[model samples]
Target: MAENGTGVVEFVLMGFQLQAAQGMGLFIVFLACYVITLGGNLGMILLIQSNPRLHTPMYFFLGHLSFLDSCYSSVIVPQLLETLGTHKMIITFERCATQFFFFTLYASTECFLLAVMAYDRYMAVCNPLLYTMAMTPRMCLGLVATAYAGAMVNSVVRTGCTFSFSFCKSNHIDFFFCDLPSLLKLACSETSLREQVIFLLAFLVITTSTSVILVSYLFIIRAILKIRTASGKAKTFSTCASHMTAVALFFGTLVFIYLKGNMGKSLWEDKIVSVFYTVVIPMLNPIIYSMRNKEVKEALKKVLRRMKVS
Candidate 1:
């Protein structure tokens, strides 16, 4: 069976339509989500950058996380809004491929970054005396750089393998965006190579991140147990809670989307899961971290005071 390059030049995404009546309502809802996502992530970035109090290694990592979320949301939400508005869900092949590439890149980068954050918490909690030495400026920079590099490599490999496959049949992508699994089903050629590539990449990235976070927390828990005072334990747990929540939410949806059996699932199923990571999580990240963190609150206040004075 050779590849089928038939009449279709582009794909029309059927984005979650229960009925015509609900389209307007859904559009309004997602539009609000996009606005909040943009505002929250950008606000956190500005807050971290402008505040002298937040110039530490932790805040430095956080600022980058916010930036990543901003880019991540930008890649997905605008197109989603357009789809909602015009009801013209058509995306060019090149544009769809580019969307998947960057979306995968930033998402993978965030996974690694979250692992780094777990390690940061572990050191800060477990080895407070040596925290400065362990997590130096150079080390932080190196960790962040590694995250971006690893994600880029993964994106290149995945996108290359996907695009290499021949698209012969119906060009209409069933989902709202170009996702690996959904796109794979549309390939007219044998997807043995692509399947193997996706499995390997998913296993490597997910396993490594999960292991790092688990090990780091083990050390963190051990250190917390060694603390004699109740107040001290309470304080340490408080510091880690927000990050743990974020990690759990992120990896949970990720695992469900990618790790499920490749059964007869529709593209709409994938799109719903994609929404969690693409739209909802980005909006929630800053709210999760900043609203709960003392440092972020203090930094915001300081920044506000400075602005008022200036």
Candidate 2:
């Protein structure tokens, strides 16, 4: 702790600790990735908003997801780039806390939002007759609002509990960014109970979200199986391919990295997986959706043609 148990005024992020040449190389690579991630997500959102055909509840949720991805990636990547560039990775206490708050907020928001998308897919497939009536604009708006509200509350609770511990010993954070696990590891106080609470909440949150998605997909599967024609089943399942891929990548990485409750694992493999979810996923999400869905490709074509004409 810095000042009578108040904690350190700032943290020094030991991000990768590579040689100067390697650090610059990695910086260029990540900087390029960050730019592409921003472009892809922003483009997705704009295309969704501009195209009349994409004004449905599905696209509405997708647009919001793109927005969140853009923001979420931005939260961590800029500082990471800075760390790689200058080799002095320092973050003040207040700034670190703020970054952590928004990080949790967006991460949790994406979790719930993905679940909501799964539910939408379920309604479209299993309850096609009532799909339009079921997902009215008001209802869609309310569901999106609930996702944001729930995530915001969860972020607040977690961030509050995390910063409550005092960091007396070292100010060195092992990771590139201000993540919860690294922050917890730096604290001088006993954090067993806090860790338990965090683990329980993470368990509940991820389990509940993934369970809803799984159940929705189970119904979707049953409904698809009831179809007599193979083509019909193929078409129905295609609608979910993009979302299913995204959910898989997301949940898979988290399960690998943190399911064992070993966030303090400073292995290079762990860092790579963390980068997969935090940096790489944002870039991949737009590509996955755009590639799997014909509608998005058509929308991009229209947008490009209009741009050329203008």
Candidate 3:
């Protein structure tokens, strides 16, 4: 409790609330996932840096995406593992706020970066002559930096707004992590302003990024349609298949969690969806890219051969 009896000093996270046997089973499962997420993301980063063939605008954005996914998982999974182990976990007010900030920052940055990647693909496929000139190393870096900067501003504002509200209702958060919807439900003060601000920021980030991706793909699809040969169309579309998959998986979850009208109505269902995006998505991204991308697969084969020789 806070000194001003109206506020909560800490929150009790009622995690999945599984039985002892189920909790231990989930702990092992989540631990395995965390390990794979780290290995896959970090491995993707190393592969990109080491392979000269991957020294292109697309791979450059991908390296950052892998880094973001790694950090995103790190922000939420460790605490979730603890919660699964104990069936409940306690987080201080400041700690919970910190988690929310970084989580928002990484997630928002990823949303923007995916859009940037879609544009990168558009330049390559829809405007091949200008691709090299348009997406230079310097330009790519500037776009990535802009994404990070925008995410930072959104995170700072959302975190400030969310924490500024009084949590006098109860200190029990229904979700595993310090998610915005879950925390907002515990706010005792009038949360209309905070909710509005959070919603507007979220709407802008998701909508703006989604719009960019949709437009980029439309242009890309037009270009593909103009190709005379089936092989040419397949090759051009293949370049973007992995990115399309990633965007759908990432944005689909965001739409369901943040944009839905029936939030806080189904806590159990929310937990499952949250786990899919936070825990499983990170582990799947590298796999998706590696499996769908021939260049990445070839690069992995070369690296493996070198390891065997050494």
Candidate 2 clashing pairs? 1-168
Tens digit of per-residue lDDT, candidate 3, span 1-310: 4426547888988888788899899999999999999999999999999999999999999999999999999999999998887665889998999999999999999999999999999999988999999999999999999999999999999999999999987888877889988888888798898789999999999999999999999999999999999999999999999999999999999899999954647778888999999999999999999999999999999999999999
- The sequence of per-residue lDDT tens digits that candidate 1 reaches over residues 1-310 is 2223542356777677656668778788889998998899999988888778888888888888889999988998888878888898888777888998999899999999999999999989988899999899999999999999999999899888888877766676667777776677777788897789877997789889999999999999998999899999999998999899999999999888888856236656677778888899999999998888999988878878888999
Clashes of 3: 0
> What are the clash counts of all predictions, listed in order?
1, 1, 0
TM-scores for every candidate against the unseen true structure? 0.93, 0.96, 0.97
Which lDDT value does model 3 have at 274? 93
Candidate 2 per-residue C-alpha lDDT over 246-296 given as tens digits, one digit per residue, 9 for 90 to 100: 999998887786676667445677778888998999999999999999999
Question: Candidate 2 — which residues are off by over 4 angstroms?
Answer: 1-5, 264-266
Instruction: Count residue pairs with overlapping backbones in model 1.
Output: 1
Question: Candidate 1 — which residues are off by over 4 angstroms?
Answer: 1-8, 263-269, 305-310
Model 3 misplaced stretches (Cα beyond 4 Å): 1-6, 262-264
For each candidate in the order shown, give its overall lDDT on alpha carbons: 0.85, 0.89, 0.93
Weakest ten-residue segment in model 3 by summed lDDT: 1-10
